[model samples]
Target: MGIMGCCSDFLQRVKPYVAMISLQFGYAGMNIISKVSLNHGMSHYVLVVYRHAFATLSIAPFALILERKVRPKITFSIFVQIFVLGLLGPVIDQNFYYAGLKFTSPTFSCAMSNILPAMTFVMAVLCRMEKVDLKKIRCQAKVVGTVVTVAGAMLMTLYKGPIMEMVWTKHVHPHRSSAPETTDSSDKDWLKGSMFLIVATLAWAALFVLQAVTLKQYSAQLSLTTLICFMGTLQAIAVTLVMEHKPSAWSIGWDMNLLAAAYAGIVTSSIAYYVQGLVIQSRGPVFASAFSPLMMIIVAIMGSFILAENIYLGGVLGAVLIVVGLYSVLWGKYKEHKENKKSKVMSLPLTLKNSEGNGEGMDIKDEDEKGKKANSMNLSTSDDRSTIKVRFPIPEIPMKVEAPNA
Candidate 1:
């Protein structure tokens, strides 16, 4: 039982780490698969609509079943929050991210997304959800880590060095037939895609922050996820109707498009949202976003395998920096959490002592009052003896007679 308890405790501690890491793999797969679907000429707007629709369908049943009892009643404010969440995530983030993926390689898109942690940290700080005390070493670590992570992401974006070949990718070569077309249109398209990715990332960061706030009210993770997906489905449909007029774009017939929508909906939207909400609830948005760099790494490797994408030395270097910064932030968070627990534990004795001291002081005050009353009574009795002596003056008598002698 003791060993089992220890293992359980350990698992609870590591669960967030494991969950976020696993989420990165899911996100990596989504990026690659979604990129493929986009390359196959699926409309990004329509894809967003289908993705959230599928997400709503896949997760609604579980949410209804699992959260039927615990789900909080949605008030008007909560409904508004859910609406904004849908706008940020499914409509803005998904559409922009898909459009970005269309113009850029999955690896570059993932690399660009490494900026999420920094953005989230800043927003969290601004929203007062995260604390920042420059005097504290842990706070300093987090600040520095966020800066370094952003710097690394920028370095990856601004600089591309010689291509780096992996052991498994030595013989893998990009097809030459598409090279001329890519070279012709790569510069402007890549710039546009980077802009889209940045916007998407900003929206994604806002979504995290808002989701954290929403959870405070709603509390039910599955229910909130389903609501977000459902709302997003509605919002995305409106956007898709305006942006994609061709009905043919919406037609799905068992291809990568269908696979992309279904997989992203079930895995990334439904499961990912629920898990991320759990993590964000347990830790803050910063910790939840901290694992994004891992997704970049995973996508880098996977993109190389699936897309035969070239890996650059600058990207490699930037990834190392990002990982270092990620660990720094995590260490700071751990230390801060540990210090908080310690402070709470240490404060317990002081609080008890304070209460005890107050009780003792009251007792002492009562005893002091009783002592003063006793002293006053003694003085009064002395005064009464003096008054009797003064009023009926009894003199000292000389006793002369000895009866035994007589």
Candidate 2:
């Protein structure tokens, strides 16, 4: 039992880290696969439609089975929040993200995405979900981190230094869809792509804030994800129909598109959302968004080999700044968490002392003395009418003498 308890405690401590890593890997895989699918002429709207349709299907079973008993009643207000969440997430965020990827490389897209932590931090503070104590080092670290992260994202978008081309990608065709092919075109398209990604990240941050708040009202993680997927499917389908009039554009078969949709739906959309909901419930939106840099790193490494991406000096510099900023925010949060724990630990002894308010610390003798004092007070009040001098005040007995028989 003792060994089992220790193992359980260890696992509890490690669970959030494991969940965040899995979420990052899933996101990295989705980005790579989505880029490939788009390169093969998959429209962003059509992809969103298929992605959420499959996500709904994948998550429905879990929502029905796991949350069958414990799920709360979904009120009208909750439904509206979830609907808006779908719009910000699958509609605004993912769609814009995919469109931006079409105009830019996967590595650059992921690099720009590193601002999510800062964005979430700012939004969370605005929403009052997070507190900012500027006097504390934790708050200072977070402020500096947010500034550094946003600066890194801006540098990544505006500056593209000479290509630090990878040796492994030498065999891949130079004209592949992985890169924009020229600095001239890249400059123009970088602005366009950055605009879209900015919107995507904003929507992403808004969704994080909304999801965190909504989860407080509705605790069922799987059900809420299923609802988001369902609403997102409808919303995406509507948008896709209006934008992509040709039925041929929606025609998907046994190809990379299908594979991408399947993987993204099940792994990234469904499981990632479910796990993130749990993480947010345990931690918060900022903590969940903090792991985004890992996704950037994974996609950078994978995009180099899979998509034949060229890593540039500007990209490397921006990546370093973003990573440093991310750690700064995390370090601040860790320090704040430690201080909070310390405060709780210190307060516990004071609470115990206040509740057990004996002149000395509580013991068996103190309890016995209390009982004897109560009995003596009863006898004195009943038989002997005299004054009593009390060092420690008693509520029932007066400190001054009150001679009732006089």
What's the CA RMSD for each of the models? Answer: 11.2, 8.4
| The candidate that achieves the highest lDDT relative to the unseen native structure | 2
Model 1: weakest 10-residue lDDT segment is 384-393
* 1-406 per-residue lDDT for model 1 (tens digits): 9999999999999999999999999999999999999989999998898888899999999989998999999999999999999999999999998998898789888877777767888899999999999999999998998888778777766666767768767656635224443363675787788789889999999998998899899998888888999999999999888888898998998999999999999999888977987898898765886677778878988898888887777778877777777777777877888898899988763112223432221111211122332111121123322211111223457989867965
Misplaced by over 4 Å in model 1 are 1-21, 174-184, 276-291, 349-406
lDDT for model 2? 0.83
Q: In angstroms, how far off is 319's CA in candidate 1? A: 2.6
Model 2 ranges with Cα > 4 A deviation: 1-22, 170-183, 276-291, 349-406
- On TM-score, the candidate that comes out on top is 2
Model 1 residue 370 CA deviation (Å) reads: 19
Q: Each candidate: what lDDT?
A: 0.81, 0.83
